[model samples]
Every structure is written in structure tokens, then in C-alpha cells.
Target: MRDGLSQEPSIEPQIELTRENLIREQDGDSKSIIVETNNSKTTKNSNLHNVIIHPRLKPAPFKIRDAYPTDLPKPTEICTVNDLKFYQNEELPVNRRGFKYKLCKPNPIFTSNYYSTTDIEPYEVSLSWFDRSTGSYLSQDCKALTSNQGWRSVRSNVGIREGIYYFEFKILKSDDYSHVRIGLGRREASIEAPVGFDGYGYGIRDVGGELVFISRRKNVLIEEGFKTGDVIGFEVHLPSLSQQKKEIEEFVNLKKSEIPDHHTTKKRKTNTKNKKFNNIEDNEKFNEFNNILRDQIPTKSKGVLYYDQFEYTKTKMMDHLLNPITVFGEKAIIEMDDKTKNIPIISNSKIVLYKNGVKQNETIENLYSFLPTNLEEIEEINLEPNLKQQSNPNYKNNDDNTLGYYPMLSTFQNGAVSLNAGPEFEYPPENTQIKPLSDRYNEHVIEEWYWDIIDEVEAQYLDSFD
Candidate 1:
């Protein structure tokens, strides 16, 4: 009586549940189920089943695979290539850091001063002059050097870490406004600045014959300043290699500990968002990632793979002045042994100047104090210790082998000077202890022979790796 025609008795709908039905339901391909009642027909979708919730797991942390092989025992004998390979490997017990060690080939013909010698030529020592490739403001023959603008300096082709040697400089041309500074500088000394402008050099200025070191004038060496056509001689004395062997060994050990193995590759996740980097930390991270990528990429020049060569005797300018000379002096004195003291009491090195053939009264003593004894001391002056350790990877400090002096000459404002690295000098000093610089040839020959052996050994060792 309430509705039109549904007054008849209503019955409950019957429903069937099956395993295949549940499987079809989960697959989202189940057909709709129809339930027919006495009063009305009803349709229900199979997807409306009880929902089950499950916990999600975070992705495994990003991992980096180890690039090197298993550790190898330190080689006791380096006679074969395999033994040399083991000796150079980072996994060995003895510490070593470098991409690869290769021997530099020796030149067949070597020329110095006005003399030339070949591998077949008899062994005869000679003096060294200004290296033509090392100076752009020098004469075509490299005998005379002139500078018309700012201060420009050039060093001789050869240098010595030990022994007493003498060289002469003649002021060929100089005006009232022209100036010159003659001295000794290490390889890191800047060629664009005065010789004594930095700690790596010690010079005597022509202005007042003033002794200059670390950019400061210490004292007057000559009462009468040198003029045009004046001859100045320099005498250098350094401790023997045996005397510094202990210190050099300690330095090498320390450097081996500090240097990291550069053979491994580093991976980093880079940001993909296109936004400006306002945070310094983010910028630094980004730069570090880029540098790692750059190092991994191979660089080819003239069809040759350009691996960074080991810089044994050269370093960056900023690295040359890291610590003060006083630090090195303290270490040198404290590390001296009885054997080192048994020799002559000339433990302290010096640089003595001579006007014409006459020796000057003032002497620059404690030359070893100025030389960098360790890699830590090869940083810029006034630079914090932490900052020195953070120097650019490509600008590392030179090895202790490079801790020596080369004949240095500087000129300014059209000043011209000629080198007399001689077997015969216009005015040779009367000092019998000091030998002419030409005698460096004997040392050079011995050094070359030593390096030739090293090169052959390195070649054999590298071949084993391939």
C-alpha cells in the first residue's frame, strides 16, 4: 500500500566468495556481481574488498666499490719489473703516493757554458750559464740579460745542493735610473720580481750594495755601490749530502704519509635542481665534485696521454714560502748527529760576495736556514698551517732534492748584465776553497748516470703493470 507494486515480501540476497574471484578482484579484471532480491536488483563491484596496508622500506644506502686490488707484500728486492710494481703499489706496507712512476729519458748530448758533450764524448765538467728557455728578457745567446720594464730575473741552467762554487756577473750597461740585483734563488723564485723579493732568494742590490733577503734589506755589504762595467762574484757553500741524509730521509717519510693515493676514483651525487647556489657549503661541495670528475677524465695532447708528471725539482711560488726560515734552522740543528759534526765546522752554509777580485767584508751566513727542509716549510709566508695543507693539488711543494740555490740575476729599467760562469774569469776570487762553477760538470755527470739507472728500473717496473 506504501509503494506502487513492491508490496510483496522481500528476501535477503545470496553472495558467493571464491579464490579465483579474489585473484581476479586483485588483478582489477573482475566482472561486476549482481544480487537479485524479491523487491529490487543490486550490483556490486569486486574491487570493494577489504584493503591491506603494508610498510615501505627505504632504499639501500648508496655504496662505492673499492677500486684497488688486495694488499700486496712490500718487495725486498726490486730487481725485476714485478718487484718494482709491488714496491710502487699503494697496498704495499711501505707508504707511497702517485698515479704512476716513470723514468725520464736522458738526453744524448748535454751542453753547458761554451762547451758541449755527448754520451760518446769524454767526461769533462763545465760551468752553466743562464738557461735560454727559462728567461724571455735575455739576449738571443743567453749571455746577456736586459729588462726595460719591471724587474725581470733569470737563473743559471744548473744548481747545486752541496759544495762550494763561484760564478761572476758583470754589469754591461746601467743608467742612473737602472738597477740590478745579483744573488742566488731556488727554482720557485719568481722571474718577474727582484731576486730578494721573496724568501727563496738572497740578493745584493746595486743601489747601495745592500744585502736583501725576504724582501727586506739586512745590511750594507759594500760601501761603494757597484756601477756600470763592475764585476761581482758570488761564492756559495752548502753542507754535504751525507750531512743532510738523516733530515732528507725524515722529510721523505713525512711527505709519504701526507700525500694521498690519487689512483682511486671518488663518486658523488650531484644536485639536479635548476636554482642559484647561495650557500657557501653547497658551492664548495659542487666544486669538489667537479674537480674529482675532471681528474678522472683522460687528457690527450698530441696523441699522447697527458698524465701529470712527478714534479721532483719544481714547486709553486705560494708553496715556496710556507714556513719561516727559523723553523727549518731549528730542525736542522736538533737533528744533527755525531757523523754530521765530524766534518769541518762549516755546518752553517753561507753566500759571500766579492767586488772585482776582492772579498767583501759582509757575509750572508746560515744559508741552510733559508732553504726549505720539509714539504710543510714549502708554503707561502704568513699562511696558516691549515691553509698550507689545503694548497691546490697541482701546486704541491717540491721534493727535498730541490732544496738548493741557483745563480740568480735581476734587472730593471733597461738594465743589462752578462754572466761569466767561467773556467776563466775577468777577476777571479783568491779563495782557494771555492771552486769555479765549471766544476759542476763532474757532479752533473754522476747525477745523470744515477738517473739513467733509475729510469731503466722504472721502465721495467711500469711494463709489469701493463
Candidate 2:
């Protein structure tokens, strides 16, 4: 009021109240208000949207500082740092306390794809019929009686329901029966009968090379049967088709009931002709010298189905295959069954047989009952329909719940034979041509042992510090 000539009318105090002013008035005069304005706007046109725009700024470049000792104080005799003093003793260098590092040689590796060390014991049993020696580490060899019709056999250490397996029988000696059969058989088969004598077992027989017999009742004259020092080879191939068929049918074709025994047929004939079978009625004992000649015919039918000669033309060629045995480790490769998870060939599982290095002309099929699944895995898979349907009484399925196959062999009395598995053999069979029984087809599927070994190694490593 003094500087102004009575300052014409203080216009600053005469301002009009706005909505913002009313809000501020209600909030109280203690709160502050800020006003911002773009004073440097450059626009030729009076359009608010035509203002120049600036791009968004990026984040500032960040850097970690280099931490280094610098400008340190000079060392002083009266330092604040507490010195760590270590006392020296007059002990010898050898006895001095230090890291006692000693490298140890690694232990030899023992691997088994099928049975572990403990589970493989059952395969080395000596049954009543077959007398296995003390050296029967893997049940690879056995001694048989020399009596005619006197038979002794044993189930193999490894049973294979599916795959191709080649086993050899070395003729250590021969008796009057002069019969030594080689091939695959079931545990339920009669131990007192040679292989192929019953339906449960299938094999080829060599009688002093005078005659060769295959199947149950088929006999063919040959130059000679296997003699001492002769290496007779038997091959087994479990095709995939057999397993697939088993999945569909409750019973596979091969497991069908065998033909009627001689006594049963003779009784039927007697009823028709008013005559009687006066001989000892033994259903297990079939007449080996029957008039009906056996052929190398593979049949998918299980029961006693009658087929006339006219049906031969319509028979599938694949069903009538007759696999031949070889000698002297000949090279004979024959394709077995269709490959599957357990079989070889990777794409389609089929077992092949080889003598020496040559492949054979024939192949064996229809052997799903002889193969085995992992015992540790059997309990978990017991409820599976496929395994339950394709079950065997000889092996555990329902009660025991174990399913596995071992190598099996049978010999008549007066016939002595030696089996060559991998462990006990003068000339071990080459594993090159065949997939190992201990080999798993798939690697991704881990087992309990895999985790067990891992946990064991970890524990051992941790214990090293103690």
C-alpha cells in the first residue's frame, strides 16, 4: 500500500474460485499445490495434437565397480591385525598330518541284463533225472543215464519265451539207446523222457548218425547221429507272431492239447472193431513207431484236428516249416519269429540261428511259453492281461507270479551230453550273431538297480569326509 500510489486494486487477491480451489479449500490450506506448464512448445498451427514428440528413453548403462586394494596404509610393527601363528613339530615327514590320498584300482564290473547274482541260483539245481556235477556253476553241463527210455533233463539257467537262441550239445558218450536230443523244452516236461518224447518238449534226435528224428514222432534216416567229440547244435527262435496271437486267444495254438495217445486211439479202435487194447495204458507214453509218419509240418492248430491230404494244398507255407539241425559249427542263419520288445532285429523281432558263421535254411517258431519276464517286474505286471493270458503252470504266474525261461535239455538213458552255455564251454559260442540274454532292448526304461547303485555311490562319497 505504501509502494503503490494506493496500488490501484490488488488484482491478485481478487481471483475467482475454481473446482480445484474448492477441493483444496475442503482439504485444508496446509496441503501444497503444484502447477506445471510446457513453456517451450513450438507449434505453427493452433492444433494441440500437432506438438513434437520425444522418444522414450532407454535404461542407463550399468557397470560393476572393480574392487581393488589401493592407497593402503604402511605396514607397522604395532599392527591391529592378530597374527596367526602355527607351531612346527620335529615329527618325520612320513608321519606328518596331511591329506592321505591313495588311488585304488577299480573293481571288475559284473553285469546281468536278466537275472542278478542271487536270483540265478535256481537255474543251477540238480534234479532227480539229471545229475549235475559240482562244477555246475551255471547248469551248463549234466550227466545222463545210459538206459533205454531212461531220461533226465533240466531247465536252463535262462528261459527265453521270445528270441533266437543257439545251444550246442557235446556228445561226451553214447549208449545203446544212442539217442541224444537237443532243443527247447518246458519245466513241466517229463524228466524221465528224452526231449521231443513228449509234446512239452521239441527237439531233433541223432542216433549214431543212422537216423535223425525231429518233432515227436518224425524220424528220418541220416548218415550218422552225433558221436563223441561231435558238436550238435540246437537253435530256438520265438517269433513275434506267436506272442501277438497269444494276446488275442486265451491259449496259443502251440499250447493246444496234443494228439491222442496210442492207448486212447487203440481203445477207440477196439470199440469200433469189438477188440480191446491189452497193453499198459500209459497216456504219457506215445508210440514212437506208429504207422502215421511225422513230417516237418508246423501247425497253428492246437487240438487233434483232422486234415486230409487235399488240405495240404491250402495249408500256409509258413505253417509247415521244418527246422534242421547242424553240426561242426556250420554257418546256417535262419530267420525265426517276428521281432518284438524282447526279441532282436530292433524293428521286427526275429531270432536267427547260425552254425559257425553260416546261417541255416530253417527256423523254429511258436515258443512263447518258454520265455520269462523279469522276476522283480513280475509282481507289478501280474495284473496285466497279456501276461496273465499267456501263462504257464511250470512257471509262476498267479501264486508265485514269476515268469522266466532257462535253458532246458533232456537225454535218454545211456546217453551222456554236455551243454554249452556261455560260462562253461571248451569252445564258447560266439555271442556276435545273437543278442545277449542279459541285454535290454530299450535303454530308457530304468530299473530298481539303477537307482540303488546311484544312491550307494552318493552315500559312499559323503562318507569319505568322515
* Candidate closest to the true structure, highest lDDT: 1
RMSD of 1: 29.9
Best candidate per TM-score, number? 1
lDDT of 2 by residue, 373-453 (tens): 211121111111122112111112221111233444555544545555433434444665654433321210132234323
- lDDT of each residue in 283-390, candidate 1, tens digit only: 234433222111111122222221122222323333333222233544632322222111112246788888887888998886532232323322222211111112
Name the TM-score of candidate 1. Answer: 0.51
Off by over 4 Å in 1: 1-135, 247-347, 368-402
Model 2, residue 255: displacement in angstroms?
14
lDDT of each: 0.46, 0.31
Candidate 1: 10-residue stretch with minimal lDDT: 59-68
Candidate 2's C-alpha runs over 4 A off are 1-149, 175-178, 208-215, 219-223, 239-360, 368-405, 423-433, 436-466
